[model samples]
Target: MRQRLIGGIGRLLAGLRSPPHAVLAHAVFPADEPLSTLPCVALDTETTGLNVLRDRIVSIGALRLSGGSRDNTPPLDYLVHPGIRIPARSSAIHGISDTDVAYAPSFALVAPSLLGYWQRRVLVGHNIAFDLAILRHEAERIRLPFHPPAAALDIGLLYAGLKPRVATITLEAIAADFGVTVDGRHTALGDAETAARIWSHLLPALSRLGVATLGTARSLMAKQRDLLHGQAGAGWAIGDLLPPHRGPQHEGAPHG
Candidate 1:
């Protein structure tokens, strides 16, 4: 009891010290809410490079899904001025070039709308920690308080948790596993849509794995974090993307 109280106090203090615009304004969904009925923003980012510390987001693609429904709206796609030269190798992979974003809006110009869209929605991505790290740095550039969704989910972590023997967890590999075709390969919107579909297919299987609620899903991710630790390309743990006050809450241990 004393330990729990001290931990609660520590979380409270951390929340108090966070920037005024901490992403989580309130718990939009309860910890016990069914993962199947959870609203989520499936998102992806095309960036200048893999190094989160120095790289920048060249484009962001996202599609929002309402609780218990499939995506019905067009994706929110943006090509932002990354404030850095797009490396040739990076452009070769993501197909975004300096000329393409020459007239694009700066990250500062798009941060408000992007942040607002992410509010009240669980952010879902493949290897989400890297994307979150890049976004955090971008927000920090503008001195904006940046915190990812308290209930964020990583498909890579979930897959690793469920299929520990799978050697790769790339979006394309997982998409193929689920029979989801590669539409916009390497494009932000295309990958986001594919992830959302793959997530939908994984929901039932994850439920069978004893991951039915947000908390259980988080617990599973926490269990699988070590497997995905260095996969983010800079040693960023999956949990590093979690909010300061919102450590992974384990309602119950996930079954194999």
Candidate 2:
């Protein structure tokens, strides 16, 4: 899997295709302290494939960023049976065979915990759209309509913007540039850790550049993602969580 990730990247540099352009959007940005001080979760997901509309989520990892700075909390990760067989090729990349998830809890069994961790907060990730798509699908699968976060930011965009001279900015590049090590290249927790490292490097630099505002950072992230698809306002959807369900606090309990 390690070689696979490395080789896949190698081909891109060897001129396999034109590297995707990362265009960050222009938007209203305030100072950095509010965004930096707020609580956020750095998240990642390993899916059955790149197509979230069709692919199932196989695993999820999130590291909470607290105290308005980059020190992340203990990571939260989970493996789940996606109710479909894991494709051999996909499993080969992630190294998670079907048997590895055979008896794993379904998403439902763990959604509350997921919500408990993620409920009503800003979020951060490397390529956050990929993770957000998986999160939206996972929520939709169980009839839970998930609106995106009120504020969200991507370390990938921040890194790209900060490094105007780097012609290419992949996660590996960003990690290498910042001296951050990725221990588990394909694992969910590993990816989340990498994302955090990316943030740790980028955010402080942004602060130094007089770009310490959260609103500005999040707006730029959305613009950068939209640029991927030749669209605008692509990344700024706000998902104010729905009110608590009109039911009991615990399963099998009466409604309030």
Candidate 3:
């Protein structure tokens, strides 16, 4: 009893010391509520490069969804001056050169707006960890405490769950499977909007599979990732199953 009390106190103190914004960002989506009834933001980012430790976010795109209705609120689309040269390789993918963002606001100036858009909502993304990692790195650079949404839904992971035996899980592959056509494939806003549409299509299917809530969906994704890792460890070359695409080169490349 005493040890539990001490642990609880420690957690309380840590929470107290955390930034108010961070505190407010905590979210728990009840299992009883249908996913379509929950509020969420689909987000995406274009970066100078794939290295979260070294690269910077060049742009962000996000749109809000709630109660089965996508708010007509214009998506938040911001171009940021990354304060570094945009590599030619990455520029070819997202088409944002240094000159395009030279006059745009720096991350520090735009952080608050981004946070405002993200606060108190679940975040959805294609390859969400990359975007979140980039955001966290940017906040650290500016000495601001960054708190990501407590819950996130990754469409890529969900797609992986749907096709566990498949080796590759690119956004284009999943989008094609669901018949979602995104005009500007590599652009931030375009990808985010595509992800939103994918989520709409996925929700009902997920519901049929007993993933009717955010928490269940997250759990299902974890299981799917574990299965993929196990398959890879058994010398299954999953990448051989699909063609290549240009996106962030990370642990799960070509997916987001």
Candidate 4:
């Protein structure tokens, strides 16, 4: 308890001491704009492990959406060469072998392009905090400027709001409920595409709930986070909800 308290305080102090540019890099969005009209991107990442503090991102997949339509532009996909060896445990989950990424470009080499792809766009994902945290960690490691998007959306949180009684909120569960097919389950691009499809289904539901803007979506997500945090305690980690292995159908398939 004491260590956690101290760590929280230290993080507070660090944020307080950060430069003005750093503080304002994540610009807030207008609350009244309809979400349907805004530019958005769905992203997913495969990493060395679940610990953001310790894990390294081995792959990234992202696709853009405009005005509720899929943009035909090529998706951003990359295999990153994490400095350390990819652990077998994580490999069993994501299927990213060390040899697969041994010759890939490092995160630093790809950071600029990734940042550009994310610029001025809202980010969406299933359990998105993990991906954002990993991205932030990589940015810090490479001494690159990174500010989170002003408005980020989580598919899991949206589903929970839509069906508060549902006990499980995994990607597969949500996909099943919406009759969405999830191809490429463990791979980053596959997961990203699935997340994008989920978002398409979620927007109308959110609209029906009077959450028609980025601001409202963010507000609801904040409330859900608070409720979950209260129920699970402050120490709860989001990555804990992610399955460590692929489902039966995806078993033995190559991951991102």
Measured by lDDT, the strongest candidate is 1
TM-score of each: 0.81, 0.72, 0.78, 0.78
- Return whichever of 1 and 2 wins on lDDT: 1
Instruction: Report the lDDT of model 2 for residue 128.
Output: 72
lDDT of 3 by residue, 12-59 (tens): 344345475654556655646568777888889999887767889887
lDDT of 1 by residue, 74-99 (tens): 45677777888999999999988898
What does the lDDT come to for candidate 4?
Answer: 0.71
What would the per-residue lDDT of candidate 2 be over residues 1-256, giving only the tens digit for each residue?
3443343234323322322221111123233536556667777778787665668877777777763354533456677678888888999888787777776667765455555555455677766756776677777888964545545676666665676566656678788888988778888878887887777667677778656667566545444332333211232112211112311121231111
Collision pairs in model 2 = 31-213, 32-212, 32-213, 36-68, 37-68, 147-239, 148-239
Sliding window of 10 residues with minimal summed lDDT for model 1: 247-256
lDDT of 4 by residue, 180-246 (tens): 8999888887899999998888888889999898767766665564444532332222322222231
Each prediction's total of clashing residue pairs, residues at least 3 apart in sequence or on different chains, is 0, 7, 1, 0
Q: Which stretches of candidate 3 lie over 4 Å from their true place?
A: 1-26, 226-256
Of the pair 1 and 4, which is ahead by lDDT?
1
Write the number of the candidate with greater lDDT, choosing between 2 and 4. Answer: 4
The candidate scoring highest on TM-score is 1
Q: Higher lDDT: candidate 1 or 3? A: 1
